[model samples]
Target chain A: MVESKHSWKAWLYLAPAIVLLLVFTVWPIINTVRMAFLDDYSGLEEVGGTVFNFGVGNFIKVVQYQRFLDCLKTTSILCIATVPISTILALLIAVALNSIKVLQKFLQTVFFLPYVTNSIAIGMVFAAMFNIVGSFLGTENELVVTAGVINNVIEFFGGTHVNWINVGSTYAANIFVMVVYIVWNALPFKILILLGGLQSINKQYYDAAKVDGTSKGRILRKITVPLLSPMLAYVVITGFIGGFKEYTSIIGIFGETMGPADASGRLNTMVGFIYDALASNKQGRASAAALILFGIILVVTLINLQVSKKKVHY
Target chain B: MADNNIVVMHERQMNKVKTASKVGGVAGKVLTYLFLTIMALIILFPFYWMIISSLKTLDEYRMSVPTFWPRVVMFSNYAEAFTVGKLGRLFLNTVIVGLVSTLLSLVITVISAFAFARLEFKGKNILFAGLLATMMIPGELFTITNYGTVTSLGWKNTYTVLIVPFLVSVFYIYLLRQNFLQIPNELYLAAKVDGTSDIKYLWKVMIPLALPTLISITILKMTGAWNSYIWPRLVANDGVHSLITNGLRNAFTETTGDVNYPVQMAAVALVSAPLFIVFIFLRKYIMKGVSRSGIKG
Candidate 1:
């Protein structure tokens, strides 16, 4: 090894990245922690207040805010619902793609399309697709899924036509749309990763199982799942992390207001809540909310890591 | 005669098993193809809808039962989308920001990666570890305070605000450093023996060897710039400075609150065209880069 000595040249090379990190990343980390404890940093100038406070007032305020609590609930439900579903869907699709011999590359490209497109733009398409009825409250056919084809199919199949994103509608419709979007959006990268993992697994296991006349289901359960566990663990962790920050897709589907403008916008996630708080001069509360989100993510990730250590293969 | 009869009977049973398995295998293959075809249709349906909707008239788009394909094929919607939505300005702004940021970040990422991979420095391991740890923290934490910092700096609605705050990606740095590390130490030593300069070796040898990864990083970075919405929306939602994603929001909405669906779809298609093109052409790089990083991590 060329054990080069300590040199100013290395520092020169590192200075730009390091400086940017300090100003943009490192400093913000400190500022978040500092601001989270303060009561009213955004309004300090008007009140001539100090920026430092060791009290837990900001945290208390965040917890006390009804909207913040609702945002947390919304965020949790979306994450819990979307993550597993997307992961499992990705796994199944990846396995299928792996098993097939013809047009593998073609199918893979089609599936990966969503990963590259702008989420918000595609979200607009979804909004339009699910917007059956197009503001005509009463229609000739009460059973029609008005704005798009999805509802028409639902109606054609003897299912009741439900409003997908109407302000007064139940959470079921919103959740169904969000889940479909998230899973579709999430599938590409997960499938790509799992496909790579699948390819890397030793084929000898399958061959050996075949020689022993093992059933396909048994082979997949006993051999394939364990080998793909590492990738599964990766997908789940990243999915949860990405799911918690589910702001843009909502914006894509609902636009900048984050949900239907008529009602109080019931679909706000934690990040969206923080952003709203910041926008509305609730910087102290926003900081507290951000820190709390950070705490939640860290705790969840650590727990995931612990679980993966036991369950993940290699 | 009895032994020969037993052998023939056993051969017949084995042949029957082979035929049954072959039948099952063919059925399974058919099922796989059928499932893939259906899934592909469902997956690509939105894209299909986007295209046909862009060709629709406002009236057709609002039809109680939407047409699978546009009736009149109103291509004028694209013109309206281009001019009315101000997509030209958005595209120019996005391109300028994307190029400037990607170029600058490339420089920073390459140099930093080189240092970490090849150079011996005090506290390198600890610094790299710290950087990696930061990745685990959600970016929402940074946005909380970065918003204040940028606002205080008076950078609102500026190109600098769009490009600078997110330039140094630890993931890119880590990715490039891993690529650089794979180049054997012997190569560096051999170059040093010839009195080759570090910068020259990096430019001449290391970079070329790592071109695939660098290309991947560049594509990813630019795509990121194109897709970015939240930060850009938060800081630069001003009409003159907005990125395409933020600009597309309500761009075609009438004062009466009814969105011109056809025009909006046209605008989305226009905004999405470049990405689709990039995906078609450079997908291998994107997949390779992502998978490489995922596997390593």
Candidate 2:
């Protein structure tokens, strides 16, 4: 009330953004929530057929689906593995970059290169690389393994030749591929954020610690971790949230990554599962799966918010 | 006796420090090189693969033996990708969408940021908060409604469907807002004292100051728009006005019948090549753009 002078103009100035957001973002959210409760989400076909029915049907169907539960578990496991590893690695990179003054920007560029590349094309390339006898870097592979350090590991294990995209129920195998791709994709931005957190930390704090005869390890553990908690929290919450909505790189039910046995069944990623279901042409079940996914996302997001509020050291 | 014991303890601590730093240092050096090389390979591998693979004949493609540099590099794959694929139209479609969306986001973001930053308006905080809250919501949750609304409005397969929905980004708005907020309050006050209106102050002082950030945001959005996949797939009825990404996808898939792997790879390389080149220059701005989010993660 006190700041009510000429309030009308702000609305005018803000109109375009507000209007666009409503049409694009805000309104869509409202529409999704409403549609989630309805029975007829088989996408506008049979136009007069029970459009937007307000009932418990979609939820019931979603909850009852065994695939939905499997997807939730898969997505959870994927996030659990990806988040901690990526976060830890990003922190380490940030710390190292902070220590070395030379090639700092160059290193940042290198680490982030994967993130800027076309993910879909990468998916295609990964599909090729993991295809049993796929060529390493499109070169002549005269032997079972490429002439690198990892060749020894393959030899030591008496490796059975395997198609990475074939095995349908091997969670570990699928997760391994996903982890590699996700981590590579995630490294750049994660490195960038961690670098930011490192920047915000005053060098004076480190100097004070040095003068106190404190070890570098002790200084990092005491001062650095606590201070960067907010940023780390942001990373973790958004990491899971982002993963849950993932669809771009994945080939859906028909995929180069998910080979003949439909290895996508082993994926367990929530978004992947829902997307697979949707792409399978079972629109009702896909909608049900999508709704279930939405609920899982909502619950996890709530937990993230509560935990962040409690622990983020702003 | 005390001196001897003190020396012994000091040696142990120093050794521990030396060992720890050595281990961490070696690990750091190894990781730094390892990460840089592996990431570089991973980033470069797809394009490298695309180019070499595209040069190979079908016999080379389907052969039991893996040919590294292709038996003979053929440039015809590029010509063939353009001719057989009708990839040129797809390129134009993506260009139109990318340009339109970027221009719209740039204009709207500038105006919105100005209002949020300079105006002495009521409920400014509330408006900003509402906008920020939208950021936390996963985009997919709202996608269903967007698809339905556009369908209802007869906007499907039109430029409106492709361009209108992404007119303003919350992320960009926030970026611009932060930039606008940094201008000294006196600058705006002086403009007002000189009888300048809100729009003029924005057009002259704030916009000029914010142009660097704005250009960076514009380039980023253009890349995002051009690279966009799922939304366009949903909006496009078939491949009528399909972008190159979608075009390559359909070509590779069984929908269009026989797909030449070499040609498909060529198309992919063609579609993604511009961004790959542009990123060479835009790399710095991306660091600027992503630093805010990346640092915290």
Candidate 3:
């Protein structure tokens, strides 16, 4: 009898969360899959209780869209480029931080400063850094204005200023700016996790290595890397998941166009594609694209797990 | 005599080795500090740049060559950004959404976590597992449908739209549930023996024990609200319901399609200030919350 009473009380406690979750979480997952299969089901049209036929037309349409392909390519490229670069850099920095005795806390705090920052705000700052102040009026009659701070630095180093994130800016230049920003944003969390992992490691392992007169490089390569593998794996997996969802940073740097002037949507990612679809009231296509992105993330995560299983020391 | 000579030679070699290692250690320490300092400056450079740019005159900002420091310090630019951006309104909306959503979410999280941790509910394990499974699915999937749901429900341009859809975070529930489980069950049993209700036991004992995690959750939730962009941009982009981010984004652009760079920078600086202050003061809670979630923005 007491057990039954407790069960009822538990249900009462769970009532609010359950109701919200049913509406927001459970229904959405089912609805995303439902809408993905529907043939161009507009949310606005659904208000009239229009019965839509179920098919894979939405998915087919999304796949055939060139911009969607471009989004996939951008998302993949970003994930491929930023994850390993940030993870390795973070590892090196964390190991260096662990070895140091002076100003370690101060440096750690400084490095983690970006973690608390608003990305949109910081993206604007970066945009200013790489932004050109003057206008490009005509094809041949280009008005030379102030190059951004970064270009100024390049000019100082005897290198010509490259047009970055401007009209006629190369895809390579835009991607470079984005890679720098993403890596900068990614570093702090990776460092924190790895540093926490490093601290928990047995000091006696280092003591033994010291007594053995082991070279520092050798010890790091042979001992530190293995012990730190689990944290590294976690960081890499999460980095990829986060990287695949890249959207707002582009908005911050390039405004809602998602790219440089006159090259709008050139740097659009999967999430951006879905947003565009949704804004155009193409719920069917948006849901299809969302499912596709989810599928990609799931596959990539599984691959990460398999790879880590083989390679991770833990 | 030969043995004594060998001993002296060995001593000399050892001294040379010791000095070399000592020099190597010092050099390594120097290199470490140098690397850290450079990295620190690089990490902090954007913030430095944001501040200086915010202070620069428009003419100086647009000069053919960038000025490292502004020739004319424009303190008035802040005032301009503030009024033009309607930052006061945005700040109020953000605070209202952040505080209301956080408080409500905390209540839901606590009760749900209590049920999961301490109660004898049927299918509790399965229900909890179902919630955890939702975490793996990218949030965009839900967002697409939620947008439709909210729009159909006539929740546009309302605080209810911002707060209601995101009230029950599975991660927070899981986090708090883990925290609740750490408390000894004997306390609950004793409370029960004394005819204490579950809610009373939760308030007096469980909440106090889990105060740190609760604090962490509150800070994270509030910051999450403050930093939210895409959702608010979609559902509530009008002047009446605009959040800080969307307001700042379009606030300083002129009719000619040119952004007033310095004023925009000022707006961004003002927008970032509260978060920076929160971080400096409640950094432990924020970090704890972040590390626990392992979810990056």
Regions of model 2 farther than 4 Å from truth: A1-6, A40-46, A49-53, A133-158, A167-172, A204-223, A252-295, A305-314, B1-71, B254-261, B293-297
Query: Which tens-of-lDDT digit does each residue in B1-297 have in candidate 2?
Result: 999997687667666655656866677677766665564566455457667877888667655545668887878888998877688888888888888888877888888887787676867898789988877665555565677678889998887888888787777888888999899988877776788987788888888998878877877777776667777878884778787666766666521112356776666667667876777887877677666533111
For A1-314, candidate 3 gives per-residue lDDT tens digits of 24466588889899999999999999999999999998999988887788899999999999999999999999888889999999988998898899887788888888898888788878888988888766554568766667888988999999988878877888989999999999999999999999999999987687557656789899989889889889989999999999999998888888888888688899999999999999999999999999999998999899999998998997
lDDT of 1 by residue, A1-314 (tens): 35456567789999999999999999988987777777666644534654555767999988988988888888898999989988888888888899998899999999888887888888888887777544445757544324466776776788966677654556767778888898888888899989989999987687657646778789878998899999889888888888887888887887766666564468889999988888887677788888899889888888999999999989
Model 3 misplacement above 4 A: A1-4, A48-50, A135-142, B1-20, B253-258
The local distance difference test score of each candidate is 0.82, 0.67, 0.88
Task: Please compute DockQ, using alpha carbons, for every candidate against the native two-chain complex.
Answer: 0.46, 0.30, 0.47
lDDT of 2 by residue, A27-109 (tens): 76665566556664566443656555667677687667686676676667767888888888788777777777678777777
- Sort the predicted structures by TM-score, highest score first: 3, 1, 2
- The weakest ten consecutive residues by lDDT in model 2 chain A span A143-152
lDDT of 3 by residue, B1-297 (tens): 999997687667556655757878799888888888888888999998889889998888878777878899998989998999999999999999999999999999999999999888679999999999999999889999999889889999999999999999999999999999999989988998899988899999999999999999888888888889999999997779888888877675321124577888898899999988998888888777787787653
True contacts kept of 3: 0.66
In candidate 3, how many Å is residue A287 off? 1.0
Candidate 3's TM-score reads 0.94
